[model samples]
Target: MFESLHQTQVIPDFDEDEVMLEDIEVEELHPTSTETEKNEWKKRKTRVRSDVWQEYTKVMVKEGDLPVERPKAKCNRCSRRIAADPNKHGTSPLWKYYTSCVKKHEANKSQTVLNSDESGSMINWKFNQDRYDCVKMYLTRKMHLRIFSVFPPAMCGTHLNLVVERGLEEIGMLVRRVREAVKWIMASPARSEAFKDTAKLYKVETSKFLCMDVPTRWNSTYLMLESALPYAPVMALFEIVNSAFVRDLKQKTHNKKSIGVPEELDWHEVRRKCGYLKKFHKLTEEVSATSYPTCHTFFKEMCSIFTVIRRMEGHEDEDIKRMSTRMKS
Candidate 1:
């Protein structure tokens, strides 16, 4: 029973070197029959190999089989082929193909929805937390006092949205600067004395200068003057003053040429010919040597009054223009 169990448990080991039959026994078999069978077996083997080759070719064609070539460099974002050479690609440590791809994707996505014009540039200011906060607060407070004086708290937000959307950030800054200019002017003893006497008439005549009134030549002058005031910044003020001076010079040159008069003339004659020159000369002398801050402060205050005027007119640009035309007349 044990011997039978051992035989049953034994497993066959198929070795290539092991002989299946002795040579003599194999030679005894029928040679013709064996030859025929061997030939048929060879033919079957060839057919099997052929079939495998055909199947492999079909698979190769279906799967787009190609040689394993070296990987080429490419821009991840644009999928544009790049040079394989490291030097050609750039050697910067921080440079990354994947990062650029992601960035390009994001930019394209944003550009698709956002405006791509000059007006769209204003969005950057909105995203700037610090700048937006300061400007928003300043404008909200100031605008509320002027235009939105009767507006409820709920309406204030709506007004702010309208202003911001209308690109009034610069206007808000202008108003603030003008308010500062007024303060400076009031603080200066010389400026106050020189202009204080003409304050009432100036107000009436310069009413067109107010942002609320119709914009006119005088309004433009006031705008330039307030815009140039030292409190705003020497650079800004200089630009304003320089522009005004150049414009005035051009006008004077034209007038002289038109009248066929000489460039050089006596002061009294000049004053008589151009009555505004006398007043301008007085204001110029008072402001010419003034500190940047003092001039800016005065300009700021002047701008504030304009802001008030603009608000009073319901923020109508047409009204400002009409008022300006009247002032010029």
Candidate 2:
């Protein structure tokens, strides 16, 4: 047992003759300067490209940006050459232009939509949980007032519907043609200016600018017709001045369902329609007053509207009676 313990304590040694010495080469690990620079350049290019692409998408969604859909780097408005990395797809410049365009569009839209917000109730108001009930009460009353003024509870829903929507629907094709004519007139600034010049030549005084009616807003149609009625004689004068142009338009659109220039009868019909919609237009304006609460006047205003329609239903004019009958249905 003592010999076994001594043997365990002894260290095993290799014979010097079996051990051989040789030179072993060690490789140095140094980063390549050129490769590092290339990596940095790649990173910078990727970051710039990503930023540019973000800008491009924003511009694409904005209104009034030309080539808004899948636009290239060239600016549609300014016709300027956008800068981009030559080695890359060079799409960043275009994207940058697009982003700038969208920002401009948003700024314009905000200006138009919120022009009256400065005078609104919330102009200088602060919001807090402590005043939650007060705010709720204010909103509820304001909403109720607006609703009653626009649509009085005493008036039948169908009555409002018949005047606003059903009447327009009854004359579907005629409304469509009028809409098309207005669209054509307002298609370009040149066309609009020409129309105004024609009005001047005919010595016709137009009170308002030509307006395009919004299809969803029937009141807008009435407003459009009202603005257009006085210009009928001027349009006739324009047709005479540019008879060849009108003839060409007629020839080109003879086979196609194109929006044609208004004829004398079309103008007369527009005037007649405007006369028919005078009461509706007045009522719409009265009810849509935002600065003043109109609920108190809803009863009187609605009664007047009903009385006019009732009288029209038995009018001597065949067209007026027919229109009233359609509204009744």
Best-performing candidate as measured by lDDT: 2
**What digit string (tens of lDDT, one per residue) describes model 1 on residues 58-130?**
1111122665443234444354443332334332312344445444544443455656576665343346688
Computed on alpha carbons, the lDDT of every model, listed in order, comes to: 0.37, 0.63
Candidate 2, 1-329: lDDT as tens digits: 88876775567996764443211211124456887898898888333435444333222222255633332344444545454434564664565566666333444424744443656543655668768877656655667445444444555433564565666665554566556656666888887888778788667665687789888777777777777777767766766776654664454342256545676776766676667677777777777788998889876878777777778878887766777777766
> Which segments of model 1 are wrong by more than 4 Å?
1-71, 87-89, 92-103, 106-329
Clashes within 3 Å, all models in order: 32, 2
List the candidates' TM-scores in order. Answer: 0.20, 0.46
Clash pairs detected, candidate 2: 56-95, 59-98
Give the lDDT of residue 189 in candidate 2. Answer: 87
